[model samples]
Target: MVIELYTYPVGFIFTFFSILSLFRLKISLTIKFGIVGNILYCLSILTSIPMMYYFTRDTPLLLLLLSRISLLIINLIYLHKLRLKKREITLEDESEIRKTILNLGTKFMRLEVREISEKCGFDRDSIIGVLKKMIINEEIYADFFQTTNTVSFDQQTNIDEIDRLMTVYKDWEKDHYEKET
Candidate 1:
């Protein structure tokens, strides 16, 4: 009785949970595949647990060929997908993503690399490294550094400066509104 309880039913439960786990968020894909592979492997151990049943010596060899082949293929495919997903830093080649990220920091004339990293969900090292490149590329600039090491964006370049820029920005907005209409 205990043996039977631990065999097909336990195997089936493992498979069921594995399938269900795919729907769960925040769990890594690698773990899901491992669960499925483990269950299929345990289930495959059933040789003759069913009374008078002969999986290996069965005359037709139906279970041996069909079940094993299908399970093996599925396991290999899932495992391969897991391996692909587990590769670190999959977005390193996508410059567009980096461009969008760069825009966040760019909005601030000057912000601490740490501040941008925290806000944008990027590491500090990556933020600073990319920021240095952006600076070199003339995509961004630091202010008030004619003789100092400080890099900061003055909130108000000048009272007059803000008013002047706001007027220009408002004019651009009106132009866009007219064009859209």
Candidate 2:
């Protein structure tokens, strides 16, 4: 009974951290937290197995095992996704994505994220990540539509400002390259 009672609280604490980790901006931290949570969860499930079988005789052992197994599988899938996302976005990739979005934003007021992803040769997640960073940095004025997976650029955004920023950015890149070589 004691083990059964403590199992939930411990699991809940780790699970909370795992879920909270998703909100973290850094993917590395999220993955670390998720891994810890999974390990703790596995231990909890193993420890609780005897109590579960003994205390709750009405519940079939197979059913309990299957349920726990499914939960573990789900956690494994989540970790897999985290690993995929751990692929860091390089500076060159960021710059290319930024340039593509800016160029497209100039031509159209709104565009599907899929369209931008295809044009830039980056995955949808990468495009979304850059778009979010740009939005946060005040480099772009836009709103995301979840239903359609599209971004609508605000009319108030100055096209001239976009052009100026791009020009200055390209100049800096050119100078930096020249210095390096």
CA lDDT, every model vs. true structure: 0.53, 0.76
Each prediction's TM-score versus the true structure: 0.35, 0.47
- Candidate 2 lDDT tens digits, 1-181: 4554675677677667767766766555665565555555555656766767687864555565567567667767876876676556899999999999888887889999999988999878788889988888878888887778899987457487866888999999999999999
Clashing pairs in 1: none
Cα lDDT tens digits, model 1, 4-110, are 45665665666666666667742445345445555554454543335325434464344553665576577667666755554323355335335644455336655
Index of the highest-lDDT prediction: 2
Best of the candidates, TM-score: 2
Worst 10 residues of 1 by lDDT: 141-150
**lDDT value, candidate 1, whole model:** 0.53
